[model samples]
Target: MTNTTKTILGLIIAILVVWGIYSILQKSSEPMANEPIKIGFIGPLTGDMATYGETEKNTIEIALEEINQSGELKRKLEVIYEDGKCSGKDAVTAAQKLINIDKVHIILGGLCSTETLGVAPLVESNKVILFSSLSSNPSISQAGDYIFRNSPSDSEFGRADAEFIVSQGIKRVAIITENTDYSQGVREIMKNIFQEKNIDIVADEIFNSGTKDFRTYLTKIKSVNPEAIYINPGGSAAVAGLIPKQIGELGIKNVKIFGNFLLGDKEALSVGGQAMEGIIFSDSKDLTQLSGSLIEKYKSKFEKDPAHDALVAARYDSVYIIKDAIKSCGNDDSDCIKNYLYDMPEYSGMIGSYKFDLNGDLLSEEFVIHKKIVDGVPQVIE
Candidate 1:
């Protein structure tokens, strides 16, 4: 063997040893990937809004597969799901179990406004970050510093719906919604917006959350002869699915029905049949602008079309955002995750660009898409 060859081999060995030590040190600095990263989930798993809950869970499950495959966090993800039932009291209990028993630092859930509000104080005080995909209450802006939602708030929805209504020359309307925070909060905002625009609200029917029959409220609104009827029935198909059929049965004609985003549901179609026709539903712009394989993939896996397509996108994007934050922070430290999110630039997600405003609300814009049921399907009109 020549001396020149031996010297070259020794140099190569020294470089390899140094690089290996650096690699080990880098890995040690990251959070342990062996143990699965646990993130708590709180949403209605069984209720009228249970369908929305299914979409949320399904999207996250799909995202977990992709996230784990990408190996971004170097850890497998494990979620502890607690049913919030889309109500405040139940949400509080779910939060207790998630924070106390599950001991999770990051929470993704509580799709209903009441659900998120119920858990916000508990999680915020404990420094746990609560990121909701669909809770759209405007009051959530001040709910807590740690609270954030990817979907545009009700304030945005209110503005869009109000503008769309007024544009249609609707000088008078009636609002019928449940007493739950989700329905009430959005209704309250739209009511105020309508008043500001000098639009008269002929009747406002607010009822308890569990009322399955709304024929009485519809009857009252019909008598008022308002140009339009706006209803937000909260998160159960029990109430929402009944509106269109009953409204048609009441012989209320010549009055357009404008509803919150929940009215875009497939159950509303299946339940109402031809009766649901011309029932206008307000939706987000991102839903229309979206272009991707998300829907196709969802259809292939779930064996049916998503009841709430926009919601599926929101929940799917949230998982990616959470995974990105976890990878960057190397740990599920609430403070770290919060800081990472606050500092995050606009994330081009499945639905649209996501950038948090100063108040932790999503800065994305929302516009009303006036869609109506046609031949048992919600179709956007010209």
Candidate 2:
């Protein structure tokens, strides 16, 4: 071979090698849509708070369907659902399974406050991201850098409720809080605000999750006959049913009753029946901001009304936010998604436009929507 020919051959080989490596790197950087992106979900799918979890999953599924069908990303998404049972110990077990066994870099939930709090330390240590759907405990603000919740904070929800109650010109109210992070945190905030407004909390009652009977506390409140009764169900959907039933059976009346966000569920009507009627509550939702198409899609897919629960919006928005992060980051560096969300601009979604605060909680444009039960269902009121 001629010397010139040999030089040209070497140049061609070098170019081929460089081109091959470049192609591989590019392919790796942008994962194929066929590849599975595994995300974990830990929530109370089988315990007392199961229905809330079930509802959350419905929204998640709808979000996933829309996302996957859009051809938005190359990688397919898969969710591994684990039953957190709304207990910290159970949540810890579920978290271990998701992180160690399933090898998920991002988790969608630990829906209730207990599960989220339980998994926060582990996920933060393992460099995993946990984004909660409905955990409103204020303590979670200090849980970890990796812990973020889409739902409004307990302080925000509580203050909104307190302000609304005082605005009604009712000076005396009774309060009953369930023993849980969500209920306690919100209860404390409401108490402080009530104190600030000079409104008397005539009777205060605290109950545990499994406490079937609340007659003693209800009897006390009945005697006081406060202008209104404010009850925090503590993330217990079951309590929504039982409490109203007992309140009715006990013949406790002559005052308006109020509830937290959890009372907006249909369980209150199906289980509480006529007893659930006329109860008032405040929640972090401005329904006019929600997409009518999304609501219709949920009804069509699930064969039921979306109930407009804040958790549904929170979880639905969580999916889209993660999808956006993944698309922007383009690699499963986990840290990339964390940084993206840590500095994310206003994300316009089902829950309204949201930006992340330093604590990883969504700085959502959420307001307390005061509701009243008129005809076996909760209706938004002026």
The candidate scoring highest on TM-score is: 1
Worst 10 residues of 2 by lDDT: 284-293
What digit string (tens of lDDT, one per residue) describes model 1 on residues 1-382?
7999999999999999999989976764565548788899999999777888888888888888888888777678888888998889999999998887667888998888889988988998999999998988888889888888888888887777777889899998998888877777778888888999899999999988777677888888989899998878776655666887888888989998888877777666677667777787778764534535887788889897766788888888888898889888988888988998988999888778868887788886554467776666677766
For model 1, state the Cα shift of residue 216 in Å. 3.1
Clashing pairs in 1: 48-236
Q: Number of backbone collisions per candidate, in order? A: 1, 2
lDDT, candidates in the order shown: 0.82, 0.83
Model 1 is weakest, by summed lDDT over 10 consecutive residues, at 283-292
**Candidate 2: misplaced stretches above 4 Å?**
1-34, 248-251, 288-290, 305-309
Displacement of the residue 229 alpha carbon in candidate 1, Å: 1.3
- The TM-score that candidate 1 achieves is 0.86
Clashes of 1: 1
